[model samples]
Target: MTNAPLILVVEDDVQISRVLQTSLEGAGYRVAWAATLGAAIGEARSRQPDLVLLDLGLPDGDGLSLIPQLREFSVAPIVVLSARGREEDKIRALDLGADDFVAKPFSIGEVQARIRAGLRRQRQATYAEPIFRFGNLRVDLEGRSLRRNDEEIHLTPTEFKLLLTLIEHRGKAMTQRFLLNAVWGPQSLDQAQYLRVYMAQLRRKIEADPARPRYLKTETGVGYRFVPED
Candidate 1:
């Protein structure tokens, strides 16, 4: 299906690449595989994949290098697949702008879920939708207003700014530093506690259950991610 989203799979291992290709195709996506960093960059540039499934370990070089390269031309989400489960590794990838990370020995279902979320976010970004809705919660980006279950909810200017920042980078796992800089400015980089306070305030107004937020999720040891549902 030419209309299907193209997913570039950058993995050297034949087995993993084959599996991902098969599963992604079966999930209604156009799949392209590149076994090395060089080929991956070429494919990304030429085909302009809707999303990228990248392996951290490549034959030519570390896959981490490809993140900025691909970012230069495309906004396609990059989901890293690696055996390195260390917190540092994940922090590095997310900091580098990798959309999401999957530890090796991952299930097809999990990967597909990540892909779906990434693509959904990508679509939102592409269209620049004026309004965002998740369940009964509705955000009017143009109007700068939010509503829950037909009732208009109020958010302070700071809270609204923070929420807007998260919505702009909807699907990607945003590091605390990134959010801080985007919403508060570079000077507030060290004030992580500001995020914690505002996030809690936001959850109270947007989430049906602030205790178990469905949209604003915490990526422990990293930061937060806003998962906007359909």
Candidate 2:
């Protein structure tokens, strides 16, 4: 039998974590729990979970700080589970690479839906077209290599995924929410800042002039589009 998808639940609150574990397992996911940022990071590295449910207010430190470390080794989608409901808090988490954000008092059904959406996006990206090219920029999706002007351009996994998502929908204006959901997962749909930050980074690497980008065009208030040629 295939092993159920593994979900790491990182929350310091015992009751909340327990409830999450029960709910996730009931939905056919295998669950792992961590009560602190340190344990969450360590377990995430060791266990290599398929998804992470992270709580920002950990006992040891802020969970937002763990995102870069987690990104380094795993492309697993991270869904933030926090009591902090401010828009700024949500933006911060998504910008740092959290796939989705679930505030306190969330319904188990909503969380489950997010999890399913995240997993589906991950699977699609993983099995997407293996190669894409525009001008001198060449992307070998299966090989995970990118080159511009025949010179190698190294990209973080997150950046690479963003680029690929844009390429997949070339010539179409992808809204901020659609791009965020496609690349960072559904929980990040509202985090336009994340898209801005990464798009700038991508432009710097691929465009001859970052300020006057030819391929990556901004739709202003909508989102972005990728043009194969000028």
Strongest candidate by TM-score: 1
lDDT of candidate 1 over 1-230, digit per residue (tens) = 98999999999999998999999999899999999999998999999999999999998999999999988998889999999988788888987889999999999999999999999887777789798888788889989999987899999999999999999888788899889999999999999999999999999888778999998999998899887762
Off by over 4 Å in 2: 130-230
TM-score of each: 0.94, 0.60
CA error at residue 160 for candidate 1, angstroms: 0.4
Q: Which residue pairs in candidate 2 collide?
A: 100-187
Q: After the best TM-score superposition of candidate 1, give how far the Cα of residue 201 lies from its true spot, in angstroms.
A: 0.9
Off by over 4 Å in 1: none
lDDT accuracy of residue 189 in candidate 2: 74
What are the per-residue Cα lDDT tens digits for candidate 2 across 60-105? 8998998888998999888888888886776666656677777888
Query: Which number leads on lDDT?
Result: 1
Q: Model 1 — which ten-residue stretch has the worst lDDT?
A: 221-230
